[model samples]
Target: MIQNEIIETIETIETICSRRSVRKYTADSVSDEAVLTMLECARFAPSGLNNQPWRFIVVDDREIGRRLSELTHYSDIVASAPLLIAVFLDTDASYNRDKDLMAIGASIQNILLSAHSLGLGAVWLGEILKNKESVSKILNAPGSFELTAVVAVGHLDESDPGTAERKALDEIVFKNKY
Candidate 1:
């Protein structure tokens, strides 16, 4: 007899539905285990030629977080969160530069969904991209690594911003050709 029985699981669609961008956060801290778990999800994301050129800087230090907050438009949110994760792309390791970037985007999506499923509030701030050179220096990123985004993570506050409206499928999808 086969010993391994399949376990029932929550629908991924439901998790997708529940995912939202949370800007405000509570004082509660996100555990290191939680951060690792989210990154593990990101680790599984597909990459071109399996380069997997994603690098991350997890900043739990309040001073560093404050500095990062100051550098981004979402200053209040970044400063308030218990943690900040700086996502990076390795330009030199990429098999195909442009395709590699799309892989990094997949990794980011994994982090966001993983955060939501774990009951943590998180937000992705692209403001850092505008000052990538300076921000990369601040983070001490390797020459091959390019800073892409910064994600703030913490406990969800009472005032949830709720889900923003999204365009209907019909509005975005096109058959065969555009």
Candidate 2:
């Protein structure tokens, strides 16, 4: 049993390392089942007081997806991806702004990792905050739900070799003194 747990731990770490912001995607469509599975994984993300304030607007319709794409700077990428998930926060349900925002971030990370684990690609768009009001209206989200991010999801185009450069542990980490 311990050996299985170790293997699972390794797999989780590998998924985190392998994930990349895939900006390009194939023409193939992402199934509804897959999207539901990703959301299920996200539901388990930790939250302050177990508030779990995150809400999602899954846009699979072509016209709605196109309109949502227009709301973000990553228009081309969002327009082409087969799926778009509008992540929102229920302000009323949150304990506080900061903690809820942190929880939302964790939930989105879980969604991205879950997508990668299921052989789907996803990119988080925070720029939507610039036009949050417009986006909120477009998605018809309730007044209490504040738009936080727009995630474009689909099968990644393998032809594009996206880079995932990062600082080494020695460069970013510090001792207790530091």
Candidate 3:
């Protein structure tokens, strides 16, 4: 049991460390199963008071993708990726606004990590939030749903986007108090 636990821990850390924001992808499409799998991982993300406010709209239609792409500066990736998952916060289901938003962020992170593990490249397009209303309208999402993020996923065309540089723990983390 201890040996299995160690392996699982290593695998989890490996996945987290190696995941990257893939902006470029191939023309090939992402399978429905793969998309569902990512969402499955997302749904498991922790939420405050067990109120899961995260909702997803899978945008596989090229026309719709193009429309959404125009709403953000990351238009090239959004318009070109074979799949886009629009993450939303169901306001009606939320308890505390701040906590629910954090939960939604966790959910989006899960989607990104899951995509990496599945050998699919995914990019979380938060820049689109500037036109959140436009995105919501284009997707036909209900008024109660607030657009949180739009993640573009597809078969990777370019080489692995290795991890970016990060600040040392001492620079960002404190022992007891800052």
On lDDT, the leading prediction is 3
- The parts of candidate 1 lying over 4 Å away from their true place are 1-10, 176-178
Worst 10 residues of 2 by lDDT: 169-178
**How big is the positional error of residue 50 in model 2, measured in Å on the Cα after superposition?**
0.3
Model 3 spans with C-alpha error above 4 angstroms: 159-163, 176-178
lDDT of 1 by residue, 1-178 (tens): 2333222134576777778889888888899899999999998999988889889988888888887777777789888989889999888887787888899989998999899989898888897788888778877889988998888888899697756799877788877353
TM-score of each: 0.90, 0.95, 0.95
Total colliding residue pairs, candidate 3: 0
Pairs of residues at least 3 apart in sequence or in different chains that clash in candidate 3: none
Note the Cα lDDT for every prediction shown.
Answer: 0.85, 0.89, 0.92
lDDT of 1: 0.85
* TM-score computed on alpha carbons, candidate 1: 0.90
Can you write out model 2's per-residue Cα lDDT over 1-178, one digit (the tens) per residue? 9999999999999999999988899989998899999999888999999999999999888788788778778789889988988899998898888989999999999999999999988999898789999988988999999998988899989975556999877787887344
Sliding window of 10 residues with minimal summed lDDT for model 3: 157-166
Q: Cα lDDT of model 2 overall?
A: 0.89
Residues 4-29, model 3: lDDT tens digits: 99999999999998888888888998
